[model samples]
Target: MAIFVHLTSAANAARIRRAGLRADSWARTGERGVYCFPVLPSFTVTHQWLRELARRGTRGGGMVAVHLRLDDDEPVLVGHYAGRGKHAARSATAAEAVHRIRELDDPRGWEVFVPRAVTAGEVRRVRAVPQGVGWRYFPGAHGTRPCTCFGCRVRGEYGGRRLRERLPHPLDGPDPKVPVLLERLAAAGEPGDPKEVAEVLYWFARRRRGPVEALIRLTEHPDARIREDLVWAVGGWRSPGVGELLERLAGDPVAEVREAAAQARSDG
Candidate 1:
């Protein structure tokens, strides 16, 4: 089988391990739904993508980029981006692929694999910086100090912590509070940020066994906006019941909700 590597944050890597790739609303134009770059043909491309991520950091903090192995036959949407090579051989064996990746570039980013279920050894602790902060502020940066940029100053003025500590971990299994969280999710107001709901659902889909169930139940929520958010969140999940739910939601009274469900179904 052909080998493919997906580069993502360590937390998202944990999510991928549990439930596979799911394209959430934050995804861009060609990647609006369930999508992933099915190949990382070379380390040069991998480093490029990681540097891009570091350049455009997330709201949470600095992130540890992870490389995950996926086989060609794995069920996923094979999306393309600038980093993917059009002419690269897709039939390369795992060892051959790894060799190609290593030969392509000298490693730079925080690109390491723990390959274990939890923290231990060199995986016990990982260093991370905030959105604007970088290796320059870390201990080994040739004695450079923090940047004097406005973004950095604002971040620090608010008592923001710079270094982030990441635990190397796989997704944790079901918890009792998941159901309660689902209930609160179902009862959430319609006018607030749907992205927040989508984010919560993404995490729940990663760690909980029955988030799909909660989501399915939320489809019956009183507000059309809530229903729309649920449908958008469901697009990220790979499940048997999801197709059925989308089918039902396709006929929803609200045009927006119906359109969201139609797009979600079409994405799969």
Candidate 2:
């Protein structure tokens, strides 16, 4: 009945640990029960706090099971096994950051689950709601079944590139479709909001891929959407000789396109 709202202090961690909390599980482990911490609106928000703790030299030796909720009181989802930061994490360490991100980015971190597969009927699901709708549905995963949402099925896109990334199977590694899907999303199904296509395309541009010089040439496509798509698309590739083109896209008029270019700068 007594829930610990603030694990912001070592005192709290120690107190929780004393209450038979298990490290890495929601339930008790060998009489060491796991203490559950819930964050409404965003269950994953705990990662931010926990990650900060790790950054500040506090490693969570005890496994903390994160429980997501709609409000501070309403329960949603519960998942287990988050890690404390390794003692050797650094800004320059890419692999460390990747591991940290992977652990923190646990899709199960949230209560409400959304599938990335946007069927024709689920268009509204992907619409730009005020962050809450998406947050309420913690990890949006599309099971093995096909999505029947309108927007998702509109152009054969489930939702954002994330849907494909978060599906239930084989998600621990980099998205396998990064290369081929980038090409297809470049030519994403037409007849919908060019903005949506641009969204998915921009996602491709942000993720992994190969070559940029050739793709930069495609940025010349007449359609503004395609142009916007290619502008960001270039950054996802690692080809040399296209830094200037990337620089130019960095200031593109479109907000998302410009955003993608800014992200590309850090990609290198």
TM-score against truth, every candidate = 0.32, 0.29
Q: Candidate 2 lDDT, tens digit per residue, 128-205?
A: 111122221123333445333322222222253455545523423443365665455456543434565566565555
Per-residue CA lDDT of model 1 for 1-268, tens digit only, reads 4333333455554445455544343232223332112235443444344434444333334454333444333333222222246422243334444444455433323222212222122122232323332233322434654443323322222322242112212332333366676665656655434655665665454331344654676676666877887776567566668888888899999988987887778546
> In candidate 2, residue 206 scores what lDDT?
46
Poorly placed runs, candidate 1 (over 4 Å)? 1-177, 183-209
Model 2 — which ten-residue stretch has the worst lDDT?
122-131
Tell how far residue 70 is off in model 2, in angstroms.
22
Total clashing pairs for each candidate: 0, 26
Q: Return the top candidate by lDDT.
A: 1
Q: What lDDT does model 1 reach?
A: 0.46
What TM-score should be assigned to candidate 2?
0.29
The residue ranges of model 2 lying beyond 4 angstroms of the native Cα positions read: 1-45, 48-209
Best-fitting candidate, scored by TM-score: 1
Please estimate how well model 2 matches the true structure, expressed as its whole-model Cα lDDT. Answer: 0.39
